[model samples]
Target: MNQTPQAAIYSPVAQIDALMPDIAAPVDAADFPQTILRFRNDRAAASVGLDSLSDEAWIAHFGRFEPLPGTLPRPLALRYHGHQFRHYNPDIGDGRGFLFAQMRDSDGRLMDLGTKGSGQTPYSRFGDGRLTLKGGVREILATEMLEALGVNTSKTLSIIETGEALERNDEPSPTRGAAMVRLSHSHIRIGSFQRAAFLEDRALLEKLTDYALTHLYGEVPGDNPPAQLLGRVVERTADLAASYMVAGFVHGVLNSDNINVTGESFDYGPWRFTPLWDANFTAAYFDHQGLYAFGRQAEAIHWDVAQLAVSLRALVEAAPLIEQLERFPALYAQAMARRFCWRLGVVPGDGADAMIAAAVRGMAMSGTGIDRFFHDWRGGVAREGHDYDDAAWDAFRGAIAGFAGVEDARRHDYWTDAAPCSMHIEEVEAIWSAIDTDDDWAPLHAKVAAIRRMGAAHSECIAAA
Candidate 1:
């Protein structure tokens, strides 16, 4: 990694070249007469060697949609088909967004600079390609909270208020507008392969598999490249599902296109963190069928993985693909147990699964705030003021007795805080309401600062361990 004196370590690279029709349907940025710098993620920029750029330069590249030097001059509106709520939708691609640029991070992993609500593209079917300022704020909160909770998720790199008022049926009309950029491991989704399979493009599918294996799954070794890629993705998807469960997150939409190939969670739309443990708690208002409910998230992701397997059949043997598919249940169970224990601040041991089950049932039955419970019971010890009179509490107490200490010493300071960091809907609305009413950004900035503090604490724990 070469680092210039002022610039962060960034190596401009175009790893997604094999996918033909590479140039995104060119669309100009919204002609916003005013561009206000709302947020900039310097930490993320440093990771990709863009921290050296001035705020004016940052706004120029991200806000004004100027091309990053030594990167793709034209953004690529990646083409893919997806299954929306188990119904195959062929008219889906980068409807309101595009892959803006590609570069290598300090660790040499390929990273993507993708946009949301920049402007309309060829795929923007009869819709204005603009993002609400409130929506951008919600995404910033979502990604921050998820990262603090240890989920592999996309980071909101930059947010620029495009200075436009937009009308919407869901929220108050004439809401403020903005554009956002997300930094993530990869933008390739399961739908990427689904599109290839749908077209019966055997050669394109093969090329995509090769590109994915080289850039995203290089460590996956096997004679059959498709099978190897499938296996690795299955493992990652399982881990991702468990992470969402532990984080108490409801992604609202688990469609194939929203499911990333690297297993990292991205695209925050109508997402919510659970207020309590209810299996059927749905995030999206239109999800009346509860297809992607909180309780059904693991199941939903497993179904998406099966769709990916169906797509992979065009490039590999069905037997091997099915063999990889069969491993999902066990993989999910193992990941759940491991991640659940990590959140509870205990080492996994005998009866770990039982403990996890008891905790979940207890929280659901008692309607205990999930985040509060974990914070109160850090190190397997109930805090001094909290009561534990119920049978479930008794079971939980006994379960932790056989385990070791918390994951890291750094977490102790966080536990000392009066309340655990939480992002329930009302709280999120409060943050946004302040901004909307008085143009006061204090609440929003404070919430972000607090969340970053929590993230720094977790990062320290991982680093020390």
Candidate 2:
């Protein structure tokens, strides 16, 4: 009888440590009884011994860890705090999660293999540490979709069901499980500094900042070390904003605790990609005030950056960091412009600015699904039937119908091509109205994938064009 593979297989932490000796600690799994689902990283699994295991065997190894031949493992939780929704919260950080150890990947990169939903830590503030299966699924999907869109993001390494049911407020009862794994970098955050600053631990703040600059932002070059580091981080944050804006993504929660100091998109929450171009669109169901609205995301990021700068003011020379912070709008504009160019399949040049602005204005008033409009525009352009600029200009014209003559022509070719971004502004509202009620994500997943594929192809064509 061909019995299924043995369930003794473990995570790749051992092999990863063996490959890179600089890894700070060893291999040990954090047992998260409430683990919702263990979503394994196929890429990472292949490098470790678990690659030979069967599905059932894989599930058996959910939170198991094998020590590397030459490494020592130390499992510990980090300390930090943040303000949730602009109100200062004196305590927060891995309340339900903990960093198991720092290890080196096969590529010689140092990464933290932490586990969320791994039971309560000292910081667990009135909440269960376990992650729900549905939540894990959402996070995996979000990370996958966002990364494919070319945004710098945190990855979902592994997700598994811990077989322990619990209660929760969001869903029906409590069917809690857990999630596990590692990430590229999980050091400090803007809130990390804030926590230290609040405690008057300037020394710790400086140490943390220095560690971050040397590790994460070391590649960035500038004349003044502090200013250069701040500037690089600002540039990355602005770039993130631009990516979020172009993709119509709303990160429901922008709490400082959720923001990564490494400048990568982290802490998945009630995120939603806008189907239409509504300036007021929000992702979280309870965010009635729209503190993190789709339109306000860029501004919110700037706010987060400013908070970080403020926290480190005493430790570093404030002038340079402030200066970098001042450049937020310009940096965001350039990134957004570049992204828009890619989406529209236009080459980088002068005058595209006016056309993009016009297109956005058209989208805002015309009530079209932002994703569909761009996809249709590119599809139309690729088919070689109508002038792309003309279609976009017509869509623009429909918004402000009084304009006429050469002004319209100039707008059409302001970027390139000859058609508008969309053919019909007439039926845009109808499209949005139809999808507004249905939150069943299966169809939306297929649609989002198609949209991303189209965007990628359009980007390639633009680069080549």
Candidate 3:
């Protein structure tokens, strides 16, 4: 790490190279025809003391993939194998993305500036490395909404529309292309461990284990680093799963590759917000079997943790890993209760976990939309709406009766609004339509503003509680 006399903010650390030097291959980014700045997250930039950079400088660093001052000499495309659908695939790695740089935030937390659709790498097989413009817009919307809902998610740092035409089966052909960068807690994934374990690389596994404990978890209470690391990762992953459930979010893809070591959500693709509670609902169109369905997210997370423990078996005894991993169910339940209460603007009481679970069932059975259900039940004060004849709704309401509301929660103007802010598929389409049809960003900007307002209200309620 290097610093100037003025308390330099960009304290670059090649944590990846330090931990697993042989894992990431240094690669050059794709040279696009044009670099047009589509979106700039100044707030995120401010955190890393980069908001002062001009647009050209921002483009030079993020779009053109120029290494930042005192950072890695070149971009590093990470390598790791992951189970795409519970089937181990050793050939996969960073096909279209790469680790651009690493620096510290204002709070002294290390953050990785990872790039997506940056260029083609060795891992990119039969694919042209590029991101669709619509994809970039969706990522921005997902991060913004998830952040507002209090989910642990990566922030979209910047989006640069590189002048290129890309063909994809997921969307329309010859769609616009762009490059995106996300500010994330960690680029290390559960797949990272799987890679080392699969290759019988104990040294790499041990280094990663210790690196996670030092960089991500800070300090563990136990002498056994592997066991303690698994425990903390389980806690955060459980909480992350609960946060998604409460937010009516379907991550669409919960593969081992996407499940990072820190448990913070990233690499948003085919994500969706539920209009109504339905366990079988899924976000990705190609997920025909619904393996990662909305209801099965927690199950998916638990399964991923188990795989992570298997990966951990290479470094330590399986008994400690399994023992620590057993704590996930309880932690998941606690997270569900706490997050549900936070959203409903109510304090947790007896039967909180069961009550929250019942509310999800009640929402489905009563035909109540997810956001509307929360908007109506905020502060434990039921508004005039919903079906009074529904038995499950009545039961849910009764179960939540003893909880008290946070003081002054209802005073926020956002609470009085006609509808709660949501990110349904149609709303997403409409926002993208504005951008695509007319190059109009007003709708997208306005939607973000509204989501932030909702977030502010929820923030105050959580703080007051």
Candidate 4:
């Protein structure tokens, strides 16, 4: 590694050493011959006091999987069993990824540095533990777009292209290889509890709950810490589902292991943004049953929360946990209405829920492109002479007229733009094709810049409000 300036190392994970055995299984990363840095999120790095580190240091820690100073000497491949499409699978764990390191962000919230495609672990069953370059690119796009839309999501911290030819059935054979590191609040999944429950290990279950309560739900107050933590997760998961709907995103995989305990969306696989307001839109081609379809996402999440509640039974009374689980539907509905109104640049008020429903109905009836409609109707006003023969459009116009105009000045400038930053399937393919065919990166860079601008405008709007 090239010598350069380094930041002061900090390790808060040592403070919670007792929780390690119950939640994580230690492992080593696969040794790759090359580590070419492809992407670095300086904005996210600054939050964790890592922006000052040199490129060489970044490649050493994130690419080659060197231990970060003051942190764990060996990486932890977390052990968790999850329900894949409602079927309990105890044979799953971190097959190709591991928890690389842990630290605190500027806000003093504990953050984790988790790797993807780093290497195989004992859980690597019938698969080569690797990640394609295309996969890394897609994750970068997913996180960027979701962040811009104001969703609570894990940020892609670093992506390094490992110079290795890998074969895969999903994409073309002998595809490019890469590794990724994500910055998230926590990696403790609902499956972590599920594993304990499956093993009938009540002690481990309670330990995991206590760890979560202290690390992820410090603000949650109550005599029953387990119930309190469950309540918070329920609320956060509801909001997350609402955000997906408003943003027109489909996660494709809603497996229990994919659902982070902190309720932040991570582990993007086969994810997509819907082209239109179709409730049945499915992201993954293999999801023949549409179990995690666009319209059914809220239901799926509620079911997952219920599963968590079942695991919490190891420590808490069934009645209290069930009460928290029951709050999901109403909380989701309120969140959807509020998020919908915010996207329309309106202050949520009386009849907001009805308006949201009507808007969805109209969009489905007219087959309106979701992103286009939002771009054209932002601020609850259509451009001059714009006309649509749809009930939803009419209802939206009438409802938006009752509220004060958007307070964010940045929004006005954003509205002047001709189109919104969108991540449709065809567009994603085109971006990737450019990289594959001609080694071009301009388009990808341009898209990220546009998305960041939109995010800044939205942030200004929220702050002003």
Candidate 5:
């Protein structure tokens, strides 16, 4: 396991092994019959200095589960408990995926590369540890679109088609099998703290909190580690919720396990980008109560944050955690206004919140897709033929008076088209149809290209902030 790191690009830091060793169990990866690389994010790989691998080498390391040089000698399936649909379940853990390696990016960000549908672990219980190829495809599409839309999201690093067939109740049985690797700022979830608190392990809780402070956040105001941690988590989660609202995304499942401490969105399942702004629009099929609907996403995340705070109370007083939790509404409001203005390519002003409210009301009154509404009114100016309720438009115009356009993105080639790139569920199905019927991947490739182009068009908005 002490394989010397051949060169700089492969030498990863074994921080988890040296720091907190009790929360995960090492396991071997399943030996797939074949490894066919279908998707490789060169841009994401480049950031972590992994862009130089040939396809064969990439498959060997990513698909065949060869240990990265100097890092995790073996994959570790993490252990934790989460409240699913507000019901606490103590039995579930990482049954299919595991943390494979850790490395530092160009910006010195501590990035973790984790697997999905890798193999069975101690927590596999009675389930087969495999992922359907279509599921992998959807995740790649979801992560790419979210990142382009300015959400802090996990990057789908590699998706390899494994030579096997998986049976599933949701999709057509005997579906093609696949395994995926994703890169993110951190894999520590709110559920991790919940597990420590559940066990009444005070020492481990402190260790986890301190580890998070030094790794994720650089510097902070307070000395009490637990209070500072909760406050930071609240701030990040608020921003995460706001990003979802601005982009009209329904996460479908806002479980504690899915909420990363870094507030980076990951674990795409039953997700959807709402075409129209409906308060009751839902993405998951089983969500009969609409708990995590489009409009309730912020509330759901706030509830998740509260669970995290409750866990933190084992180490710190409830009052400080409550104080930090109180910041969510205000912080969420600010992030919504800020990100909305960022999308509209307008400079933020004192009236940014009111302006965003007016814009939202107009979208609701126009009965058009939120994407179209934003596109027609990009730069805070209504186009000639795009008129909503006159009163709402008046309110919008009044609220947007002093806010100037940040930059002229119309010069970009992407804006030359009449429409912005969209990821409506229908288009997602069409892209999958070609693959399922004819093994054609052109549509998926083209969509990724178009989405990246849109991101490039709005690069100034992303960078200026």
Candidate 6:
């Protein structure tokens, strides 16, 4: 917890990471695929003023670093285990990720600035420390798109593509090498709690809970030993689950390692947005058994919360923790309702809210494309023509009928001829294939353009909500 001079100033959108004293062994990044496109840059974010760094400087920049100005950096290897595809994996720490440093933002918020694909460490297991260029690029686009969609996500601070190559089953011959700097609230996960549970270390679990509650959920007041600490954590996690559902997002892999103690979205691997309402819709191709399906995300999150509760069983009383966890579904539903109202540009009191869900459900069941549905709904259009005609209006009416009665019908017309919720018309097929193919940037770039437009429109609509 060192303090540095705040002689330097940065805008709200800009972030700064101070260098650490002790340097670790350098981990070389692999090379890009033949089709991979590379853009070299010295500066990190376009808006940030941080100067371009050399390879030596880049390595130092990503190494374990010191806290800046008025922040703290506790670079401890968090303990955790996860069930990878239903089979338990006992050892999984920051195998390839590290807390490079921590910093205090201008708003006095503590943020964890970390590196992924930097290099191998003691916990490196049997894998390469390098992250593929495609993976890094995918993460960058994912963060930007998610932020635009109004989801709680980690922001990509920088991406460094190296000129190296390696082999990987997940990609095309593994010629890509890269590293990324990400900004997040906390990187501790449910697996960390599960790891402590497996070891029967009540003391370590309690310590972790206290750290998380004190740092992440400071809004929840009360220090009633470990019970309150566990309660706060459970409550926040359930709330986070609700946020995910409202956004039609599936984390794809909600393993204990991916569920953050801060309840903020983390570890964006194999994630996807559902275009239909099937409870079993999955993003990962190898997921033969839809374990992390779109409809089951809430259940998956709740199960993770239960594991967290199990971690607190010995040190903190479990009954209260269970009670708090029980409230997740109801709280999630309410938050989801509010979020849906905002998404559809309706007031919570507006009776139209009721019909909208049914309409959406009907569209999904009837094979209306998920993102396409929203895109078109945003603009007043039907499946038939780009023109907003009576026939198009009739199709909407037919969809609204799925909602049942008049009470639900009120929510039917948020879509007008003026504003259409259009998906990336040219890239619709690409969206479907990106999940199936190796890392692809063409669709992502197109999606980002659509998201930018969507974001600008939301500015005016959010106020209306």
Q: For residues 1-465, could you state the per-residue lDDT of candidate 4 as single tens digits?
A: 001113433434643465767677888888898999988988788778888779999999999888888877889888899999999999999998998888887767888899899988888897678898899989999999998887889999999999889999888878888999999999889999999998999888877877788877766445997798899899999999999999999999998888988899999989999988888999999999999999989999889988899898988789999899999999998888777767777666788777777777768877777877777777666765556645647766676667654665335477677777799989899989998889788898888888887776666665222
Which model scores highest in lDDT?
3
lDDT of 6 by residue, 326-412 (tens): 877776776665555445444454334455555555555567655555555442223355443333244455543333221221233
Tens digits of per-residue lDDT for model 2, 387-426: 3345545654443232222211123222243422321223
lDDT of each: 0.83, 0.59, 0.86, 0.83, 0.84, 0.57
The C-alpha RMSD in Å for every predicted model, in order, reads 2.9, 9.2, 3.5, 3.9, 4.0, 7.5
**Per-residue C-alpha lDDT of model 3 across residues 1-465, encoded as one tens digit per residue:** 001112336577777768646679888999999999999988777777778889999999989988888778888888898888788999988999999988887767778999999989999998788899999999999999998888888989999999999999878778889999999998999999899999999888888888888877777445788888898889999999999998999999999988988999999999999888899999999889998999999999889988889988877788999888889999998888888888888887778977887787788787889999899888988877644556867778788877898777677789888888989999999999898889999998898888888887787774322
lDDT of 1 at 311: 94
Lowest-lDDT window of 10 residues in candidate 5?
1-10
TM-score computed on alpha carbons, candidate 2: 0.75
Provide the global lDDT of candidate 2 against the true structure: 0.59
Q: Which stretches of candidate 5 lie over 4 Å from their true place?
A: 1-11, 220-222, 388-392
- Report the C-alpha lDDT of model 1 over 1-465, residue by residue, as the tens digit: 001113347798877776756323545666676789989888778889988889899888888888887887777788888999999998888877888889887778889999998888888898898899999999999988998888889989998998889999999989999999999999999998898899898888887788788887766545898888888889999999998998899999999999998999999999999989888999999999999999999999989989999998987779999999899989988888777766666666778788888888778767788898887877677878887778767677777788776557335477788788999999999999998998888998899888877666554443211
Clashing pairs in 1: 8-49, 24-77
Ranking 1 against 4 by lDDT, winner: 1
Q: Model 2: runs farther than 4 Å from truth? A: 1-38, 43-62, 65-72, 101-109, 219-225, 379-465
Least well predicted 10-residue stretch by lDDT in candidate 2: 404-413
lDDT, candidate 5, 252-360, per-residue tens: 9999999999899999989999998888999999999999999999999999999999998988789988999999999999898888887787887798887877777
Give TM per candidate.
0.95, 0.75, 0.96, 0.95, 0.95, 0.75
Sorting all predicted structures by lDDT, with the top scorer first, yields 3, 5, 1, 4, 2, 6
| Evaluation by TM-score, superior candidate among 2 and 5 | 5
Which is better, 4 or 6, measured by lDDT?
4
